[model samples]
Target: MTPSNPDPDPYLTPGYRPGGATLPRETPPGETPPAEGGTSFTGPDDSHNPTDGWAAAPLTAVLVVAALVVAFFVAYAVWFVID
Candidate 1:
């Protein structure tokens, strides 16, 4: 038979402390690290302004009122049919 393995299976390991250096080392002071693709949020301000257009509160209120009115009508119809 083959010699028994000393190290346990890495996949079967539990918790944060698996075996080796699983975490990234802290960046040095003043030195700018290279932009990590997708992970890094620091980039061109291409995001649209949230307050550029009409507020969502008005639209949400209108939708809520419409839904409430529809619900009331449905309840009324069901009550009428049952009566």
Candidate 2:
């Protein structure tokens, strides 16, 4: 009996043994594995906004105007006041 050459025989191992019966299936090219971690669907909460309806707009406007008024008065006192 002749020994099977593993290099030329797909069914033979090195000396003369059969290889693994199941070969890996051929996967189509360009296919990637799924993402490891699950995806998330969320956004910032609406509580950050401190306004409601027309009242909210006017309230924000009033606060901005008040800040500007205070800034102008402070500048006048610091630079324009008689020394």
Candidate 3:
């Protein structure tokens, strides 16, 4: 039989076998994986979730209008007081 080449079978020949246990089958212990239905979803169900501090366009428009009104009144008061 031809010699078994060390290059072809490194693990079988000597001290080169893999060192650790096989990787975990499921997530490691205490890992609290996504809720338990094999569906694996972890967050709110809504697909179009709004961010915490984000506002929609209509709300932003209202805020801008209100700010402009307040600014106009403040500027009018300053002008009236000066004149």
User: Mind sharing the TM-score for model 1?
Assistant: 0.36
Candidate 1 wrongly placed segments (more than 4 Å): 1-53
lDDT of each: 0.69, 0.62, 0.67
lDDT of 1 at 39: 45
Instruction: Report the alpha-carbon TM-score of model 2 versus the true structure.
Output: 0.31
Expressed as tens digits, the lDDT of each residue in 1-83 for candidate 3 is 89775565544432333664344553345443455576568767887866686568878999999999999999999999999
Cα lDDT tens digits, model 2, 1-83, are 99775566543322332444443343333333555675453656667876556787788999999999999999889887775
Ranking by lDDT: 1, 3, 2
User: Candidate 2 clashing pairs?
Assistant: none
Candidate 1 per-residue lDDT, tens place, 1-83, comes to: 89999998756543324445443333233334556688467777777866666678988999899999999999999999999
Rank the models by TM-score, top first: 1, 3, 2
TM-scores of all models?
0.36, 0.31, 0.34
Show pairs that collide, candidate 3.
none
C-alpha RMSD in Å of predicted model 3 compared with the true structure? 15.4
Evaluation by TM-score, superior candidate among 1 and 2: 1
Which candidate gets the maximum lDDT versus the true structure? Answer: 1
